[model samples]
Target: MSPKYTLSLWICCCTLFISCSANQPSEERSDYPEADSLIQAALSEDLFTGAVLLIAESGEIVHHKAYGYATLYDESLRVVPSPDSTTTRHLFDLASLTKVFATTYAFMALHTDGKINPDAPVSQYLPDFNTPQHRTITVRQLLNHTSGLMPWYPLYYRAAGSDDLIKEILSLPLSGVPGEARRYSDLGFIVLAEIAESITGMSFDEYLYDRVYSRIGLEKTVYNPLDKGMEDLVSTSHGNPFERKMVYEPDFGYRIDVDPDSWRNWRTYTLRGEVSDGNAWHAAGGMAGHAGLFSTAEDLLLLLQAVINPVSGSNDPIFEEETIRMFTEPDEFGNGLGWAMEPSALHAETLPQGAIGHTGFTGTNFVADPNPDGGRIYILLTNRQHVGVDGAGLYPDLRELREKMAKLVFGEQLR
Candidate 1:
């Protein structure tokens, strides 16, 4: 379908929702005072510069709030954070969330359209994996991270361009036999991105937006926010010390050597609206399957709604409910196609099994409960990287915060 036609259809759907009582909000507002307190505490401690927290219960938005500042530091003037600029609509670099929101959706769309088979060997499309075992890696294995691929690599330093990057990813030796382990491999998703592009004969970003997100009515999610005329994004990272400095310096001509322990004389210019992931920004130009999609909390809710339930009555709905369920259902390893299954410490232990979500390195997460008894979705977006990479290592209490937020959202259900 054409972009124009899909947009018009989305507008019609929005109008329909607004006209009906389905758009009317519930009378009793969900209280999340503890959640608010946690955000304030995080901000005061400089753990996160800003965040957008969103909660959806039974398809209705209950809590949507923004906290702190988007662009906190001003290196030019050496001034402290100014919060007058923070807004709920600010775009955030959703680090690894790109796996589920973009790459997974693209894979699902191709499967639904009969353009690709989940069980087929990825080498069928991208034949660079010429070895016996490598050639046998199925699309399902890649999605479930059972492709025996390495978890990650310094692709930014290794590859000269996008083509070289994919080659570098394919050249990595298998960590184990495919389908034997549950290693979460970014390399697999990188290959999956290539598979999607190879199948559709389009760029990964183009295929993702044109084929998946646009059809599902996501207007704010994008691959390269700055390139697409979007400013006002949550800040992340101080500078690319690893890739840009250690590998290719003049852009980041502030470091002498690659030392994870060294801290003095480090470049501290905050990354505002720029991707923090070295592989995605430096190698892929802010477009990659493993990372580098920017989106707002509200934009994500649209995609979550489609995932939590079926998108019915539309001619070009992105994927069938059955397809979504199939993809989200846990495999033998307790891993979904792209989602991280719940009963995780990320959510309340009392919540039923089968809750699913993914977390980003930039302190962003979204989780949804599949059980009908407590059907809810929660999104927490934080630019925790604003304090730089070392900050994340130093303050590794994010899991604690997530657990608290989950408990607050789930309320007395945990009791």
Candidate 2:
């Protein structure tokens, strides 16, 4: 499909949702006071600067609202005077949620087109992955994060450019035997994206927009929102301070294998409409498999609805029903293909076993229960980085608030 035609499809999708009574909503009249209060308290306590929350019960939007300030910090990272407020339309960087929404979707399209085999060694597409250890890695192992790749590596310092970043990642030693352990790895997804690009001959973000997201009626999901002419995005991070500390501070939880002074081009201004991830921005230029996608709460809800609530007995544009099942149905490893299942670290233990979702580093989350009896979707997006890090020099972790909200959203179907 041409970009022009896909844009028209996006316009129709946006208009159809806006014209519906269920899409545009006022939460004051809804019964989610508990969730509202939980978010409100977090904002009051400065957990984040702004947020957009959306909840869908059985495909009907029950609550959708924006709260707090969108552009909270100034260039020097200080709280601004009269911070700009946010609307539901403002985009927040989805961070690692890109793994499932962007990269996984592209993989599904490739699978449908008979371009990729889940069981095939990645060397089939990426020739550099032909090493004895790397040769044993399969696409499925990467999806389930069983590839035993180390969780992170700062390829930004080592890569000459995007072309060389993949080579740098492939040079790293595996953390464990492939398919034997379930350590989630951003490097694994970055390699997965390289495989997708190698196979499709398009940038990762372009592939998603052309083949998956736009085709599924998503108008706002994108890799670099500012480059696409989007303004007034939710702010994230003051320069790259937290990530900078991560590099120099050896005891910082995530291992950084590069020298602290290896890279000198650190960003020094507050981030808006730019990806917050170091590798995504510095290495991939806002188009990495692990992070960089930005989106709105409602656009994300529509994405969830596309696969979870497709038209009955119709040829779904994105993937076949069996394909969706392949990714959502958890194996004994406690995870679906690229998605995290319930009881995993990504969700509350109270959630039913079949619930599927993912979380982003920039304080974003989306989870949906596709069960006929428990059809519900909950999304919470907050700009936790806008307020900068706390005494520990880290962005406020949204996991506590995420768990609280998930419990309330799925209270009726808690396992």
Candidate 3:
């Protein structure tokens, strides 16, 4: 089948499944007028081109709504178009969610089966990491971003070629003593990828696909969309801020447009059938502990449901109950394994103390509150980066929309 036809068929199948499931109605179908109103307001304000917002309570999908066009073009600059409907299944560059979906989850599975010890020195897996300073870095430190490795060091720049990337990464200097402090580091996850590979004797992507995604029925989630016949569902964008236009580096090729001024030619570099992150693309978009994974809002919700009910439909939990607790619990820095713990000012009232979730740099955010009687999950996916790359305030607007929806659903002030 053609890539476009495959995606169209997948979207149609999911939509039909949802419609059939909804007709059978359970606890999830309870009226949520306020939630509906909030989503309507967001769509009316043009905050999102298209979104699939679902709310579940007591193991039921109570609210599911799709809005906006799958594709919306800007006449002045000819920006990449957005998806027209929730069923359209636009590809979302998962950004840091890779930390959880790719890295943390992998480790959890390994740790659960006794394949790895969190406190063991990383050198045990990757022997090249035997430098005195490196020998002390434990798997636990890497999981918590306290590995003392610099947050990131542009391995793409240091490595002479793709084959040398791992060598260059192994030679990086430690930024601090391992386990001394918490500093979110992409490099940490990159190293974790190497460790996972060494221990499993399989590619990182293979391990995740066969173990995690397939088990959860996450058909649309994968390390790289290009590999999975997802050429059509992918979204494209310009660099942020609209000032720093994208520039092609000889080594890294095309950048993802994180600065301003790139918005005008955003479509020129529209990454429809490619990975957006230069590092991931250069690495061929396989599993990376740091980034790389494309999925839609509905697929993500399925993953979250698995997180909530780890033992449901599967005997093996994605994370041990303890590990899941650690991923959701806040550290001294208020960040968990791959998620942010604290609520923004906008949703502080609605978000409980133990609420856990993550935000993708590409205008995607999800929050799951496990407050038992009143817990709710909110997912908002957009391509605000499509408008401008360097823009920093887009999240606040997204948060406000989520707050509004929460307030409407719960019938109280969420902020």
Local accuracy of candidate 1 as per-residue lDDT tens digits, 1-415: 8543453343334322322233222332335667667776666555666677888877777877776557655544233544323456779999899999989988878878888888988878888876775888899999999989878666655678678876787666678999898888888888888888888999998988787777777778998888778866777776654433443343433233234343233345767666778777767877888898999888898887666765544665678767888898889987689888745624445444677888887889887876544588889998876644442233234776787777767656545
lDDT of 3 by residue, 330-405 (tens): 7776666556675662243466567777665655667776554556676666654443332432322566676666
Cα displacement (Å) at residue 143, model 2: 0.8
Please list the C-alpha lDDT of all candidates, in the order they appear.
0.72, 0.80, 0.62
Q: Which ten residues in a row have the lowest lDDT in candidate 1?
A: 15-24
How high is the lDDT of residue 26 in model 2?
44
lDDT of 2: 0.80
Q: Over all chains combined, what TM-score does candidate 1 have?
A: 0.82
TM-score ranking from best candidate downward: 2, 1, 3
Q: Roughly what TM-score does model 3 have, to 2 decimal places?
A: 0.75
Cα lDDT, model 3, residue 158: 48
Candidate 3 regions exceeding 4 Å error are 1-48, 74-76, 79-88, 160-162, 239-268, 284-286, 314-319, 344-349, 371-374, 390-399, 402-415
- Clashes per candidate, residues 3 or more apart or on different chains: 0, 0, 28
Which residues of candidate 2, in runs, are more than 4 Å off?
1-31, 312-315, 372-374
Instruction: List clashing residue pairs in candidate 2.
Output: none
